[model samples]
Target: MHMKAIQFDSPFNIKIKEYKTPTIGKYSLLVKVAYCGICGTDIHIYEGKVPFVTYPIIPGHEFSGTIKAVGSKVTRFSIGEKVAINPNFSCKDYGYDHHEYCYYCKKNRPHFCINWEAIGVTMNGGFSEFIVCPNTSAFKVPKEVSLKEAALMEPIACCLHGLQQIRIRPENTVLVIGAGPIGLMMVSLIEAFYKSKIIVSEPHPSRRNLAIQFGADIAIDPNNEVLKDVIKKETNNYGVDVSIEAVGGTTTAIEAIDCLNRGGKALLFGVSMPEDTINLNLFELYSKELSLFGSFTNPHENDQALEILKNKLINVSELVSHIFPIWKLEEGLKLMKNKAKDVKKILIQIEDNPKEYSEV
Candidate 1:
């Protein structure tokens, strides 16, 4: 059977085409993709900025869908069940093609695998009517969870991992730089889980308002306001306990490091370019006893993301500001690239059925 798919043919080029649907193999599930979220990496790929991305790729890693068919060996999932994709692909299976685990994988850090092949980055991904992924990458979506919201599980898991990088407590004053979708997710998750005093710094007014609505205790316009003053006043000059850089820029990263307590932890959660560079003060970093770390893709946290979504502990639905059909994916990409003030998360809807058992 033929199905519609969006492909990034080359840099500055994208087109929708009818492609042959993939058949499921043993231990694989044929998923009819319901929704896929347009992420910053997708924008980077479209602009030919993602260093690892190749041309002629179906780029969508954050997605959810229903099982259309299951291979004979796929016993964990059944047909018509909802599932979310875990795009992190481990390329270091010991017995596969005589493969040996890389240093990172050997250290149990597959997120930093030397030969990582993420679904959207290296392999054909979910910007299509159907996809075939191994059962290990599929996490069952609860009946009460909408597939549209379930599509965001990947990002939620990533943010969850980021949160784990820092030791957040109720007394900690947390600051998140940038109020984009990921930053907003950080705010919501921190609010729900840590109950920390949250502050968000965003230049855009709409995003600042959104941060407040999503449980930010304070939202400051970084471009127009003195962010350090706000942080000092909020924390009684102790600075924040933790700072997260989500804007993926050197300035925000510097700001994140600057606005921290003496022994605070900093989580750099943004996706920066290969050429980007940031200058740091090694003396202060040492004198203040600061800890800084980088967070990569989600690692074995999809089930927790599903639990968070299913329990409705965080308001992820509010993060989705726009939804476009699969045919208009190009327009959606443009909206994401332009960073429209109101556009928090842009979703490309392939199939809209939310019921547990239903035909599209």
Candidate 2:
């Protein structure tokens, strides 16, 4: 089988290549990809911000697919069922491969592997028709969620991990900075998990507007409206109890911290570039007792993401704004470059099935 893949050689240099089908190995299954979501990290890799990408590595982790061939020992999924894959790859046995005794993975937190080989970064991913991943990485999709929409599961799991980091009490006021895909996902997850007064800050007109549709109680553009004033007024002069910074920029990180009330928590969910440094008011930190930290990726949150979809707590379909074929990966990336106008989830169409099964 010939499959399409977007190969990145240098910064902003991605060209599609047709590759032959990979031979399946023991304990590895080949899946015909159905959809792969272009995440912010994908764009970062395209811009050469992410490290450890060998030349011509395919960049796509948020994906769903149907099982094509299962390895001899695999008994998990069948050929005809739809599935979502959590592309975080780790080698638990290899001492150098992964720091198994690390703070997170010591207690079986495999998602937070110290030496993680992220599917898209270290290995080829779902930018093609077929993907060969471990059987345990695949999650069965619900009958109601489309395969395209199921691609959002990876990001959803990530957002769920971010949420799990901080305690979202129902009494607290939460502010989500930057209403991009992750910010909007924060809005969606918070809606399902917490009933706090949720607000979103985004300068983009279209995304700020879509924030409301994604369960943001209020959407405030920092350019036009004062975020501090909005939060103060909404929370009766007290700032938000918790603030989530989803945009990997110094400015947005500062905004999230500034909006946080005394003793409030600021969760940095976005992975800023290594060179980027965020400024903090030490006085605010000392006097206000502000809590600031970063949430890297999912930690056993994939199961929660799958369960949420199965339960219909969050409607992933509403967020899927555009769809394109795998051959149009460049076009999709271009659309992502202008993502503010084309806001929300964009999925790559691979194989649409008539009936979604357990092992698709």
205-249 per-residue lDDT for model 2 (tens digits): 899888888788888889998878888899888788899998888
What's every prediction's RMSD, in angstroms?
Answer: 3.5, 4.1
Give the poorly placed runs of model 1, Cα more than 4 Å off. 91-103, 352-360
TM-score of decoy 2: 0.91
TM-score of 1: 0.94
lDDT of 1 by residue, 1-360 (tens): 999888999977889889999988877889999999999899888899988888889999999999999989778899999999998877432223324777777777878877778888888898999999888789999888999889999999999888887879998999999998899999999999988899999998988999999999999998887888889988889899899999899989989999998999999889999999988899989999999989889976789999999999998778888777777778778877777868888888888623332212
Cα lDDT listed for each candidate = 0.87, 0.79
lDDT of 1: 0.87
Residue 264 lDDT (model 1): 90
**Which window of 10 residues has the lowest lDDT sum in candidate 2?**
351-360
